[model samples]
Target: MGRAIALGLPLLVVAEIAVFVLVGSWIGYPWAVLAVLAASFAGLMLLRREGMRAWRGFIAAANSGQHPGERVIDGIVGLGAGVLLTVPGFVTALTGLVLLFPPTRSVARRGVQRWTERRVSSAVAGDLFGPRKVRVRRGAPDVDGAIEGEIVEPR
Candidate 1:
């Protein structure tokens, strides 16, 4: 994953530059610059709005005795979308816009949840989202009783 990100960042930058140049050529440089500025402004507004909404949702979920993982994940996705839009790139702005919608946001949230579950330990995940079904196996007990042992100090 780290390697992919290392390579992907440069590629993304190149793609963004290419797209910007293409759009500028078609619509004129000034319009393209204005569009980028507009996108950045929109992104800032979205970030503020989503931040408030997420905080409210988190508080409501907690107060209602519901798991807050979903709301927390929603906030994470919203923040990601806002950051993506803030970055000066059309492709990222498009992606951020897609994530702003409810349906797409839900999908993104689910994907993030799955990715996190895979990366995080079950115990930790459970702690965050409450108890989850997990498989357990019993190991055979040691047949030999406790062995005599002494801690020796190293010189």
Candidate 2:
């Protein structure tokens, strides 16, 4: 992940710059600048609205004695979308808008959930998102199942 980010960041910047230049050439420099500014402003508004909605949902969940995990995840998604929108790039803004809309947001939410489940332990994921059904496979009984490990004492 770290390596991907290290490479992806630069690539994203290059893509953003290229897109900006292309758009500018097609629609004139001033219009391109205005478009960027407009996107940023729209992002700010979305951030504020989503932030409040997330906060309210979190509070409501807590008050109702329900797990706030889903709300927390929603809040994270909203925050990310807002930040992406605020970034000065068409690519980021488009990605943010995708997250903002309901259908796309749900898709993004599921993706995040799946990613989280993969990265986190089952126990932790269960605590956050509730229990998940897991499939267990039986190995051959004749095969040795003992594991080997070496524990080094700290000097």
Candidate 3:
């Protein structure tokens, strides 16, 4: 991840700059700048609207005794989209727009979830000292297993 970011960020910046120049040339530089600003404003408005919806959904889910995990994820993704839109790049703005839209957001959500889960598992597995596998058979102790009382010796 670190390596990818180190390399990808510079590449992204360069690409964005190139795109900006190309667009500015095609249109007028002033119009191009205004377009970018307009996109940013639109994105910010969308982010605020979606963010409020996400928060309300979270609260409703919690009140109903349901897990608000999906709502949290939505909020996070929305926030990311908002940030991307504010980055002053057409590429980033496009990506952010996709994330803000429901159809594309669903697809992106799955990818993000998988990536996050993989990263979390790798970190956790690396940190643990115990065996990774657990052997279980039908009729093997209770779910919590048996807890035997042991004497503690003080030094």
Candidate 4:
């Protein structure tokens, strides 16, 4: 799987470059290039604004000593979106924008969860709730009895 993704990344990059060039040529290279630059800049601006808001909310959540798990997850996701938004391409910018928004991210999270549930061959009941460690059966308990996080581990 790792190898496949590694190989696929360059292929995707090539495809994106081809599309960019084709569209740029059709629209006139100067205008297309300018548009790409403008969109990338706009994306970065939006990311900065959203990130600030999310940070403020996180600070508030942490101040109250409430579960800050979701905020941390959102921060991680936002950071990734920030990186993608900086890439010079319409498709990546669109995806990055979708990820930057809360409603869209919620939908994406559900889709990813469904994918994960299907990938696992055997059901591990109380799996996420159970201790993640593999130790002596009678060793000290490890479950924190909390909704630890909202991180979506990549496939």
Candidate 5:
């Protein structure tokens, strides 16, 4: 992940710079950079504040004795999105906004749900060091083959 990010960052920077140059040539460099900075900052601020609001709601639901695991996940997503929006790049900022938006995010969330279902379902999520999961169907086996509790003497 780190290596992917390290390599991708430079490419992203180059793309952003090209866009910046194009916009700067049309409008002026100072205004273009300022606009990008302002937009990124605004998006970050909005999502960060909204994420906090969602976190507070999650806490409230948890305190009410309800399962808030999904809320916690949303909080995590929101935090990541918020941070991404703060970065100085159009793509990153747009990705963050998509994550923050409910309609778009719901699709992303469903993908996550499917991934969790395949990779780690309830058994894995429920416990890490717990016993391995085993599914037994009906009529598999029973204790009727042996006498109850007491062992028979060897003939």
Candidate 6:
């Protein structure tokens, strides 16, 4: 992921810049600027709305003694959208707008959840039982008809 980010960020920046220039050329520069501004403003409004909704849902879930995971996830995604919208770029703004919408946000939420789960599982698996190894001996006794193994202490 880190390597992908290292490579992708530069390409993303170049693509965004090229898009901006092309848009500016197609429509007058002033109009292009206005369009970007308008998109940002709209995104901000969407961010605020989604943020409020997520907050309210969180509060309601908490008050009702229910798990707030979904609400919290929504709030986090909305916050991300707000940040992206705040950034002065068309690509980020469009991405933010997509995250602001419920259908798109749900898709993004699932992706985020899956990514988080994978990261957490890997982290847990990495530090399991303080570095241990399994050893299979040729004469090991079987237990309950299951293959037997032993933990090999570090030499």
- The number of the candidate with the highest TM-score is 2
Could you tally the backbone clashes for each prediction?
0, 0, 0, 0, 0, 0
**Candidate 5 lDDT score relative to the true structure:** 0.67
Candidate 4 accuracy as lDDT: 0.66
In order of appearance, the predictions have TM-scores of 0.80, 0.81, 0.72, 0.61, 0.64, 0.67
lDDT of 5 by residue, 58-95 (tens): 77876886655456556666776777778876677778
List where candidate 3 sits over 4 angstroms from the true fold: 119-155
Cα RMSD to the true fold for all candidates? 9.9, 7.9, 10.6, 9.2, 11.2, 9.4
lDDT of 4 by residue, 84-143 (tens): 777898677777878967797876655554454446532331132222232234445458
Model 5 — which ten-residue stretch has the worst lDDT?
A: 146-155
Distance from true position, residue 10, model 6, in Å? 1.6
Candidate 3 colliding pairs, count:
0
The number of the candidate with the highest lDDT is: 1
Q: After superposition, how far is residue 148 of candidate 2 from its true place, in Å?
A: 18
Global CA lDDT of candidate 1, please? 0.84
Runs of candidate 1 exceeding 4 Å displacement: 130-155
lDDT of 3 by residue, 1-155 (tens): 79999999999999999999999999989999998998889878877877898889888877877656566667778888887897788999989978878988877766665455456663443232112333334455556877434322112
lDDT of 6 by residue, 74-147 (tens): 77788889878876678888888788788998888767754554566534422321334668767756676666
Error of 4 at 8 (Å): 2.6
* Stretches of candidate 5 exceeding 4 Å from the true structure: 112-155
Ranking by lDDT: 1, 2, 3, 6, 5, 4
